[model samples]
Target: MSEVQDSGGEKKKGKKIRAKKHSTHIDMTPMVDLAFLLLTFFLFTTTLSKPKAMPLIMPDVNEVPDPSKQTPVDDEDAMTIILSKNNRVFYYFGIKEPKVEQASFDATKPNSLRKVIIEKKKECESRLKVGGKTPNERHKVVILIKADKDAKYKNMVDVLDEMNINDVPVYAIVDITPKEIEMISGL
Candidate 1:
């Protein structure tokens, strides 16, 4: 409830008359109820933010997979990429006795990692015998990524971005080996 009251009282003739004063009262219960209702309405109607994540698809364990869809990759078809300190990248084409050649993350240069992966992808795709099978069934590039202890996490993220950019079909983040560490230590 709101109310207004006049403060003027009877004045004596010899005394100066005082200015009239008015008092106001405002009830805040309805305003508070309205504010809470608006807050609750907005809270219930708004959607909460979702967590960001990278996707990882795993095979269904219960369902039997058809063997026709699977194509085995040769050892020669494998490509290994190693991430070292300072965002450096080392790549080799095969599994055994890899030359351990260094490639830059730079996109502008000819020997950049993207160029190498794209070239290797094309080569492996060419080597697959897609005789009667559909194009998707053909063998694709398989990349193995390993990171050194000294390597920065950003390098791994960059390599993952490259994989996504090139649409690489098969790849895994494998653990680094001591032998591989020795190979790149001098470089």
Candidate 2:
């Protein structure tokens, strides 16, 4: 009877120990699904903005000179100077055809156009002064400058400085048309 009672007590204790060995696990399926949804939302909703541009203000010329007071003759004195991106300088005098001057610059060297323009300005001024006529009084003494689209800002600035030094004030800038911009952009 004692042996039977001991065996029964040991079996009960073993059953209780087995029952106390418990495990608890949590499911992470919902958290992982939420993370993936947030990633997808960010990937599809963002966009980059276009770059900002600098503003340019050009000089205005509205008043036309009186034709009755002016004498029309063959092209003798009007000058048009063009500065090209390929470092070419062109001049047109009293004619529609332009003459390209053999001129070039080393990208690493200082600009030589400034000196050339200064000399030209002096020549123009001397002609006007010796002839005893002001710029407004002379119809054929005007200087027109047409700069290239890709010319350096510093080069243009040097040109302007030369003009200022020589008292050549009036000038115009050629603009790129909206159609040209569209064609270039393929829009």
- Quick one: best lDDT, which candidate? 1
Q: Which lDDT value does model 1 have at 107?
A: 90
Candidate 1's C-alpha runs over 4 A off are 1-52, 56-72, 130-134
Give per-model TM-scores. 0.62, 0.39
- What is the alpha-carbon lDDT for the whole of candidate 2? 0.55
Clashing pairs in 2: none
lDDT of 2 at 178: 46
Question: Per-residue lDDT tens digits of candidate 1, residues 29-147?
Answer: 99999999999999999889977677765456788888899766667778999999988999988876688899999998888999999999988776645463666655578999999
**Per-residue lDDT tens digits of candidate 2, residues 65-168?**
68797655334445555555545554445455544443333323344554445555555545543355657544324555666576567555555555565566
lDDT accuracy of residue 123 in candidate 2: 57
lDDT of 1: 0.84
In order, the Cα lDDT scores of the candidates are: 0.84, 0.55
